[model samples]
Target: MTTAAITEETKAGDANGATAREGRGDLLDQVSASPRPRVSASSSPSPSSPPRAEEIAVRVVGLVKRYADGTEANRGIDLEVGRGEIVSILGANGAGKTTFLRQLTTELRPTAGRVEVFGVDADREPRRAKGMMGVAPQEAGLFESLTVREHFELFARLKGLAKREARAAAAEVMCGLDLVREARRRVGALSGGQRRRILVGLALLGRPPLLVLDEPTTGLDPDSRRAVWQVIRRAVAAGATAILSTHYMEEAERLSDRVAVIAGGRLAAIGTLEELFARLDKTYRVTWRDEFGAERSNLFGTFAEARAFVARESLSEFSIARVSLEDVYFALAGRRLTDAGGAAGGTNVTGAAGAAGETRKEGAR
Candidate 1:
């Protein structure tokens, strides 16, 4: 997708840009020694038409990250997320999902490309850009000595809340994350899932306009995971735009407005779930047990075609279903969703180029 360039009139330091950066650092510092966290006025807003560059919450152009060991984790990635939209980045284990998020959060500096958050250049002013966002890294160190409530309250204060506001915010977060019952318990005594919840709660303290979460529910039980999802939904309902990386297809399908598939350090495809599903010709799926009792599956353009294939194969037991996001993922990445390792070269079946080519062909026709 092409992102319109930010006009000089909207570049940082302009009157409007200054308003965007205002209170990002000063307001919080005024309340305490803690740096002020900047938040956009609203994470989610109803826009009747396409958003302009200045309206984007995050913009990444030609982003590239190369490590000292000569490993390139990202390559020429271009993405734009509008205010109030939930965008999910999906990929195999080493397909650069974390790398992309880290750069967006300013946790890791990119070797090349430009990143802008809320109109501020992240590369030149990471701290200022970060003030506009709440980030929950994949792994973070929590103080075991702090109680759950203490952790939330303290972090709220650190995010620039006053004493009374901090307490109220902590209470709200605890209730939202279902950590109220464990509020007074020390972090060290909490289970892994509980600690994970605390980490997520910390990021939500001030209801920052943007939330960048890297697998926020990784270790939680199903119930806890659902609770977290509710918290995220509530945040979005209140106008928070969220970007997250998740292994759970259900999470992506349910939570995201758009899904981005990354492969070989590049964005393989990005669109709504329906748009991605449309990329595949085989929209029908057939599954059956072979003579050896092993499961076998195939895809066809239609249910009738799939049924006919089963009949031709003399399969007695088979099921036909609509295509799912997993099929789109496998088609794009040329591997199952659960597969690990880097994007294997020449293995992508439906990458960005292929998708673009398909679009061009349709337009030509």
Candidate 2:
């Protein structure tokens, strides 16, 4: 839909003059009554074992989200997060990735279907459902007036960690986020990368069984981004399940066990990178311009398959290439992930305004 035709569903008040929070009741009732799918986290690792329903930590069945302005942000999406799995949702801007995540965490009510986290309905029991979740939004959500310790303190409190225990947890998290030295410094005074790291740290503060991070590394220098990757891996290793939303295909390729491509609010594809590529039937395109003035290109399933073909065909001046996740992103979204949001979201995650709040609101990754 065009911008002129869209009304913001995120506006301040509800249609009834009550706060929008009250409007959630009807959605909550539907969510509360829906059937739940469960999956166990500690089942045996047999390769041939089929995934059991009880082993799923998060499930979205026929999930749909439509904005008040008639824009459907999620068009009948079905997704599952196994115990301890990192499932990445990849898309370009306006592709409905974040909107879908918002549904999983109950920040946005689904217009149809349900979201279940650890056997609890997010729509019906949002608070109880959230207790099992830790969400790190793309935008830096830290309060400028609060120090690193205070930031984690707020999260720990929300997660039900006690005061003295919360302080200890905050210190440990600050150390991991590389903000130990700034624990006492006001968040407003920290550098951009520092704040981003701290936001990640806060998400981990609760030690929730399920973690949902929206654009966890949108902004930051290469080093800071790498640091976040390390932290995420650690989180997964500890048996916590995670859902990552990101525009960076490389990040998703490296971290996710499975990924779903969203386009214009629809789920275009869902599977492992290899599985989706296989389903798309996209082949490795080997291209070469020969001395004989002929342009040669070929498709192969495996690098070995391509190599054998090259030798058999005696294609001397050939280059072998495979479809990249970035390629898949474009084929599904109709635009480059990096280009849709632009490099600006990464470099000026705080956006151009640079007022601390503006900067904080600029980027989430």
Candidate 3:
């Protein structure tokens, strides 16, 4: 969408005053209620399964975003997400993950390229595109004075549900997000973790066909994080598509059907965990402390090789195992997992190089 067009829409929405949120809410309800092609399990296979003919939930072509100050947040990025799939985006703090998502959510306009949500042009028909999506931004305001139940009910009603239906929907979402115990408490009285769960619950309302979550479990504890994962898995199992960005490697590895790594304002790599792991020649890793107590790690092509090296080194404190998702991420992102949100320079061995190679292979085919 053009900047001027977005500005005009914002102005119009503001002009509507208190009714604007309600209007948008109603639009969501209408969109969710409309009949569309169903995504069968056979048609929309999971990442672990073979590909089949399925609807595309999201498509981006040569997407780019350049700020007024000349900072390029996204550059010539292209991606496609299948219906009912969960695609996790991983990147450093300034790597443009949020910028990519905001464009998909129509909250930000791209400087170049196209974004389509469920076949609707996101740039040209943002409202129609958004009607099919539920978004939980990294940060958003909440009504502190309102109770949790009130927040859900009010938002549900706005989404086009009748009073009773809204109530039931709110209750269901609360249960799924493990917020039922706090339903009667004011949002202001809740803990940060509780509030974060509420934000995630808000997106699950009405079971929207698509969900865009940015650090949805950021403040939650381990148990709460797992609950949110369950909620996401349940939604996808019921044929919902999700695109989320998270810092947790476990979250990305466990929940995502595929992973996308972004670096320096560009997509560095995109593939399933197995597909990504296949790119590495050294599939086994061994870690140990040297005789002087310094830590060391070695990679080998096979487990036997790693074990043989361990014996040859007479390593007493050491571990040998197959490479993990974190290894793949480090390889592709060219940085340690902990350094994910750090400064923008690393090995440059993965990401851009890997993605370019994949692009070349596709072109050749």
Among the numbered candidates, top TM-score falls to 1
How well is each residue in 162-196 modelled by candidate 2, as lDDT tens digits? Answer: 99889888987776667788989998899888887
**Tens digits of lDDT, candidate 1, 32-142:** 232112221121221223358767988899999999999999988888888878888888887888999999989899999999988899989998888888888888989
Quality of model 1 by C-alpha lDDT: 0.71
Q: Write the per-residue lDDT of candidate 3 for residues 114-144, one digit (tens) a residue.
A: 9988888999999888888889999998899
As a TM-score, model 3 comes out at: 0.77
How well does model 3 score by local distance difference test? 0.72
Error of 3 at 302 (Å): 1.3
Clashing pairs in 3: 1-123
Candidate 2 Cα misplacement greater than 4 A, ranges? 1-50, 280-320, 338-365
Candidate 2 achieves a global lDDT of 0.66
| Candidate 3 Cα deviation (angstroms), residue 168 | 1.4
RMSD of each: 15.1, 17.3, 15.8
How far residue 203's Cα lies from its native spot in candidate 2, in Å, is 1.1
